[model samples]
Target: MNTPSAGTRWIQLGLGLIVMMTISSPQYVWTLFVKPFQATTGSGLPAVQVTFTLLIVLQTFFSPAQGWLIERFSAKGMIALGAALSGAGWAAASQIDSLYGLYATYGVLCGLGTGIVYVGIIGLMVRWFPERRGFAAGVVAAGYGMGAIATTFPISDMIAASGYRHALLVFGAILGVVGFIAALGLRPPQLGETPEIPADKVASAARDVPPKTMLKTPLFWLMFAMMAMMSTGGLMVVAQFAAFSKEFGVADALVFGFAALPFALTFDRVTNGLTRPFFGWVSDNVGRENTMAFAFALEACAIALLLAFRENAYAFALLSGVVFFAWGEIFSLFPSTLTDTFGTKHATTNYGFLYMAQGVGSLLGGPFAAMIHDAAGSWVPVFCIAIGLDLVTAALAWFVLKPARRAYLGVPVPAVPALAEPLAAKPLAA
Candidate 1:
């Protein structure tokens, strides 16, 4: 089999992005339909929240299966199926009159579809762009976030013009068709069975550690914790931004929805893609520890601004940009950190396990924020919790990750890539 050239890899990246745009786009911009969905169904806030909570739960519940499915059918077949399920679920959801119907169709069926496609793109991108995994992963993942800017208005308009059910059917059909087309373009690298070259001239060594042994390592636990902390706060914001804005005195909820504009979405995509290479390379050169520590610190600051100074719209927008950047960058950096530490022999499976951390984090985060808001009448405590978690993560990254990267690189603590005085580490950015 002929290997895809670098240009072909870029094409795969575009297809992966399109899949993200079609299926994974709705999660962040869910706020757009909350009011309308509630109005149509006569449901309360908790009921509405439960629907989305159910969506996250179902999506997370199926993560392992999705990962396993990717390995079995490969990326193309699985994501094509995902696209069909997602579109069909949403379209069916639009016609539902009861909460239960919505739950099964939108929450479970659609969630399952999302899980399958979402796993495929990430695993596919990392394998395809072995030379630039972080940047490639970032570019693919950024589609999920940026997609909202394009879909939000149209989806909202569809709901308004044709009602929610029609909107769902239309969107679902479009997603299904597009997904099928893109799936045809998906293919794994054709590198045969050759092992990757080492990052240094010292020669690449393979890990003899079994999966169970690697899981038992303290580094695995720490990285899981890091991913969870970085994600929960961001997802909380994504899930609740509509309600949060209303509480914070923004009269127009659509303004918040429309904030998913080209500028905002482009910022999200560009920063996320840029940061992957920037920080991954930095992690390669400066050490994953220092890069993560810096990311954690920056994220903490962004959370602080959201909590303390969001009374102003401009301030909120500025902080939103920071939040998106941090969110995108953190997502990109962790995989690079993992592959750097663990090597790539079983990269897909290992990354899939770590990806479960995001699911756990989102599971805990979405409802927790709502429950807190129900109790406290503000997002203040939620923001505080996120900030505190980030600070602890920063400390952990500073100490634990630095040492782990050393062990993985087979170097002394003082000689870790980021810590070495001469800092002449190899560039993994490109």
Candidate 2:
């Protein structure tokens, strides 16, 4: 095979971002399907919400194995398979008559499909952009966050027009096809493509640490806890935005001639997508921990204010957008930080373990939050709990994650061993 040029990585990055975008609507716009699902099955809120939880839970919980499979095979092949499955899952969901079938099709198939593309893309980016890991990870993750923007209004309109089944069947196929086409160009980095850093260097903390060893570190567990909390607040909003909007009496209210629910969802998608790359770029220069503190603190404040201004359609629309802005950065921040600490060789599988936090979060944020709402007849307690998680996780990032990562990386390289050598080692770039 010919040597991969330096500029080729950019092309790969673009393709990865496209794939991420294609897989995104299944997760991001799921709230749009919640009510339709409930009406069709005559199921209650908590029960309907289980589909959302299972989608995320399966996506995240099985990711370690998915990552390993991607690593062992070709990213291009795995992604194509994943895209097909995800798209078909949605289309199949259009024909399902019962709740269990929804769990198997929309929940299980979509979850596993998206999980492969997600983990595969993240790993591919880190390998290709060793020097700009934060930016690379952020950009692809931004695609996932932002992708639903293109579908939110259309799907809402579709459901209003022909019903949810037609919407799911049509758009599901579109998303899958687009992702499959984009993934044709994606694969592992060429041997000489990634620059190498000395394991002992304090500035460039690059070493190929395996997944098994990484799991034993206290540092890794701290990250898991922090990620779980951050994922909780954001996911609660994603899965329940429509539910709470109706409950708070803002769903049908107008905020610039658009219904508040779809409008808020649209705005939230934009901010959520933009924050990943923006914060990732900032972290590249100012440092990751500081960015985490600032972003997490903002998320906590935004959530608190969103609840306070919940009654006002304008506040609900805008503040909810701000809430997402702060929350979405975790996708970029955690992956980059993990790569910084654990090394690039096993970025996919290691992040898979960390990504399970999102599954933990989906449970806490989805059915559990809905159960709280059904019992209390309010969303206030759920918001309060989410706020608490954001605040505590933010503090942990500033006080715990930052120092722990630094101290752990500070250890002498001689104490550590590489799981596998770089494909080709070269001196670090200045």
Best by lDDT: 2
lDDT of each: 0.68, 0.83
Model 2: lDDT equals: 0.83
> Which segments of model 2 are wrong by more than 4 Å?
1-6, 32-48, 156-166, 195-204, 371-378, 411-430
Model 1 C-alpha lDDT per residue in residues 1-430, reported as the tens digit of each score: 3345547777888998898878765465566667877887788867876777677766655665676677766668888888788878887887887777777888887788887777677777766655556666667666765666667778888878987777777877887788778877887776652224335412112453334656888877889888887778667775566567657764242334554333444454456545654565455445556767887788789879877866665566567667666666766677666665565555555666777788878877777888988899778888888788878888888887766655654555563444422222232221
Residues 1-430 of candidate 2 have per-residue lDDT tens digits of 2345857889998999999988888887887888888887788877887887678878899999999998788879998889888998999999987888888889999999999989889988987877667788999999988888778889989999999999999998998888888888787886887665333222334466788988988988999999998888777776788889998899999999999997887788789889988988777666677788889889889989989988999999999989989988898888988887887788999999999998898778777888888999998888988888888888897778765665665532324433221212223322
lDDT at residue 224 of model 1 (Cα atoms): 87
Model 2 clash pairs are none
RMSD of each: 4.7, 5.7
Model 1 local distance difference test score:
0.68
TM-score of each: 0.84, 0.86
| Residue-level error in angstroms, candidate 1, position 18 | 1.6
